[model samples]
Target: MKELVEVLAKALVDHPEEVRVNEVVKDRSIVYELSVAPEDMGKIIGKQGRIAKALRTVVNSAAAKEKKRVTIEIL
Candidate 1:
């Protein structure tokens, strides 16, 4: 799960090397915190948060099979 977020971030940001993903496991749910270069924030989040919404959707669906809730936070 961490890897997936990392890959997605790297692809979206110009500073690929600065992309970072931290995972926090809480009970049956997984939380992912993604940090990218400040200048690349707009690209990752997109206009009106459309990209952010899509990202969360993808992660949630992927974790559905495991019956776990997934949350993504961009920082």
Candidate 2:
């Protein structure tokens, strides 16, 4: 899950090397915290947060395959 966020974030950001994803797993859900260079935040988020929404949707779909719930937080 962390890898997924990292890969997507890297691809979206100007400073790919600065992309970082941290994951926390609980009993029923997983939380992925994504961080990128300040300058690239807008790019990752996109207009009206559409890109972020899409990214979350992708993560949710992937997690559903395993019967898990996951949330993505861009910080």
Candidate 3:
């Protein structure tokens, strides 16, 4: 799950080396915190958060196969 977020963020950001993902596991859900270069934040989020929404959708779909609830936080 961590790798998935990292790969997605790295692909979207100019500063791929600066992309980072932190994972927090809970009994019922998992949280992924995605951090990118400050200048690349807009690319990850897109206009009106469309890209962010898509990213979350992809992650959630993958998590659904594992029967886990997942959340993505862009920072």
Candidate 4:
């Protein structure tokens, strides 16, 4: 799951080396925090957050098979 977010974010950013994904497991859910270069924030977010929404949707769908709630936060 972490790898998925990393790959997506890295592909969208100019500074691939600066892309990072942190996973935090709570009692009932998993949180993925995606961090990218400040200058590349817009690319990750996209127009009116469309890109971010799509990214989260993809992650959530992939995690559905595991029966766990997953969330992605872009930082």
For model 2, which pairs clash? none
Off by more than 4 A, model 2: none
Number of colliding residue pairs in model 4:
0
Query: After best superposition, candidate 1 residue 31: deviation in angstroms?
Result: 0.7
Which sections of candidate 1 miss by over 4 Å?
none
Residue 6 alpha-carbon offset, candidate 3, angstroms: 0.6
lDDT over C-alpha atoms for residue 49 of model 3: 99
Residue pairs with clashing backbones, model 1: none
Better of 2 and 3 by TM-score: 3
Cα error, candidate 2, residue 9 (Å): 0.9
The models' CA-based lDDT, in order, is 0.89, 0.90, 0.93, 0.92
Per-residue lDDT tens digits for candidate 3, residues 1-75, read 889989998999899999989898888889998988999999999999999999999999999999889999997
lDDT of 2 at 60: 92
Q: Write the per-residue lDDT of candidate 4 for residues 1-75, one digit (tens) a residue.
A: 899889988888899999989999999999998889899999999999999999999999999988889999887
Cα lDDT of candidate 1 equals: 0.89
The estimated TM-scores of all candidates read 0.93, 0.94, 0.96, 0.96
Q: Which candidate comes out best when scored by lDDT?
A: 3
Range of the 10 consecutive residues with the lowest summed lDDT in candidate 2: 1-10
Clashes of each: 0, 0, 0, 0
lDDT per residue (tens digit) for residues 1-75 in model 2: 778888888888889999988888888899998989999999989999999999999989998998889999888
